[model samples]
Target: MVRTACRPRWSAVVGKPFSAFPREVNEMIEQFFGPSAANGSTWFAPLSLWEEEGNFFVDVDLPGVAADAVEITVEKSQLKVAAERKAPEGERQYQHQERTFGRVERTLVLPESADPDSIEAELKDGVLHVKFGKRAEAQPKKIAVKST
Candidate 1:
């Protein structure tokens, strides 16, 4: 009989396997960040979306980004948010650098119910809040039933 040492698989040590992530997750990552090497200087601003009272809302985290450096646009059924975070001016030796400085952009597809004309956006406390009101037809309508 031969004896051999056992070793744990990479997936076992990393929890979920790389393939365990859903396709949509991979697609979303690609859509938001693009290929890793495509733009090494570029970083992404995390964001969240939700719906309430027949309206949609999106909030994006933009830590050091300036309001003037941000741009929001809507075309057709798509909404695009872009911003730039500039690094500190003047030359300095940095002990450590973790924060990212570059252009970051995200494009979202608005639902058919979304009203582009009703969209509103505001930036405060390093967060960008975007709200999209629902179309008149898309708003919930209470139906009445009549008895003969």
Candidate 2:
């Protein structure tokens, strides 16, 4: 079993399945969760990725985070989303508190034909919606010609 130690800057990690994940993901997850996060206990069911009808959608459940606390970015064909969840103030001790918090990020390599120019992102009712379109070149096109 491979082991990793991540701490400091634990604010830049994104957790996803290793089989479907990349090295950057491990780095980001470690950066956010710190050295004690690699045991799989720090994250449960990391973010999910999906698609339908030629459109790609990523739905992240961030119950305790506010819209303004999240950061979403698209760079070099990769989309990165990060956020921080803070417990309510006033030194409240908890016997057990298990809610994804502190910082979480998800990175995806958009299809080569993704249209970064026409992307949209919004957080509503505790869920984040990041939308983008596939380039016409990527979508199947039809052509016709008259025959004599």
Candidate 3:
């Protein structure tokens, strides 16, 4: 008679399959981040930030949001953006909802070289664009050295 060694699966030893663990985690994430009820719960939006030519640019996605409802402020080394997105009028029932609504706020820590006074922002095409100019003193300066 020939016998072969067999390895025990982790799920089999734990009673529940390991594959179900990921699904449970996903459900928890969705429950926390996904939209809830009809007019309750807060959600986060996507933001893009980058730097170019001694200037920092921040792009915030704010679709379905009114321009008048948005506000941007620069305080110390922190940049704050606040906006509100109202849901459509006469809402009945939703089978599946993913889009976020209501008050939304995002804050970013500015670089040490960022000039708060030179900050500018404009919202166009449902996207909020903010630019921060670096301080002149923070820019690199050329120095001349004498040959020995």
Top-lDDT structure, candidate number: 1
TM-score of 2: 0.65
lDDT-superior candidate, 1 or 2: 1
Worst 10 residues of 1 by lDDT: 1-10
Clashes of each: 0, 8, 0
Ordered list by TM-score, greatest first: 1, 3, 2
lDDT of each: 0.79, 0.67, 0.76
> In candidate 2, what residue range of length 10 has the lowest lDDT sum?
1-10
Q: Candidate 1 regions off by >4 Å?
A: 1-41, 145-148
Q: Candidate 1 — number of clashing residue pairs?
A: 0
The alpha-carbon lDDT assigned to residue 95 of candidate 1 equals: 69
Better of 2 and 3 by lDDT: 3
lDDT of 1 by residue, 52-109 (tens): 9889999999988899999999998999899999989999787666566788888889
| Ranking according to lDDT, highest score first | 1, 3, 2
Error of 3 at 30 (Å): 6.4
